[model samples]
Target: MNKKTFLGIAALLAVMVILSAYGHKLERGSDNVISLHKLHTLAQKGEQLTWSDFENYPFEDIGSGLYIRKYEVEGGSHLLLSGGNINLAPMSINLVKTSGERIDIRYEEIRG
Candidate 1:
């Protein structure tokens, strides 16, 4: 191949590499959601759960056993619950979805 053609190919390859890296970074920075029911079940079953369990969905404990899991995705955010009263059961919580940044979950123990 001629020198000009070789240089053109090399430049194209470099652009592809840079674009690939940027795409990967964007994917990693995207937000995520977790199953609240699964979380509660795990805690009730004597399983030790941590922030790492939620995979890409990182969370922050905002006092009173409440947690906030933030995601960058838009719409269709919700929480699921199963058997037993959430307010009175171990690892019970009210998963509340609010606008922007993070989803709020209120967790408290209730005695019957």
Candidate 2:
């Protein structure tokens, strides 16, 4: 397989594993599961999202044409990359898409 394809698949798998592993804790009842674009309103104020805060957020960004799927949770967040360029700096992972839109995630775990 091509390197890009491999990396993309690997990244997607990694995200899926992380979500399927500890995402069952939230009290959304029956496994909230990756619910996206459907969110007309985001979480309440001051939620701990690595990066979900958006101004004039495009509905598509939620999950429409996504290849990976962006998820903002407490301990960590996950983003789907549609062949976007990723920038790694400090403690954050930022993926910039061809459209110039950016998605970021941080590598950290919250023990609560």
Candidate 3:
């Protein structure tokens, strides 16, 4: 066994690992997809939204104004705003992407 042989084996293993992971992801499938921007807009309307409102995605309220939503596909954009007060307070807006199936949103004011 030489260094060349060891390197070749290592490369082959790496490729196999990558392919396996990708195959697993594909098997998971994507049937529930959501757009964060649309969610944000609906949230702003102050009309308590529910999982049924979405197409196929179901969201779970994890607690503390935090919500977890899952999607089957990715590639969406959203803007999130957080502040102590709506008119005057420290606020932050984040532009995020739906690169994965899992999405987390927070509604500090809206609670159950």
TM-score for all predictions? 0.30, 0.23, 0.33
User: Where does model 2 exceed 4 Å of error?
Assistant: 27-112
- Candidate 3 displacement at residue 62 in angstroms: 12
State each model's CA lDDT, in order.
Answer: 0.44, 0.38, 0.45
Which regions in candidate 3 have their CA more than 4 angstroms from the true location? 32-112
The sequence of per-residue lDDT tens digits that candidate 3 reaches over residues 85-111 is 434321333334544222333333321
- Residue 84 in candidate 3, Cα distance off native in Å: 25
Q: For model 3, how big is the CA root-mean-square deviation?
A: 11.8
- On the 0 to 100 scale, the lDDT of residue 6 in model 2 is 100
lDDT of 1: 0.44
lDDT ranking, best first: 3, 1, 2
Question: Residue-wise lDDT of candidate 1 within 1-112, one digit each (tens)?
Answer: 9999999999999999999977875785644455444444543533233344445554343334444333222233443232133233324223434432222233332111
- Residues 1-112 of candidate 2: C-alpha lDDT, one tens digit per residue: 9999999999999999988755544434432323333221232222233233431222134434433334343223333423232221122334333445544433222112
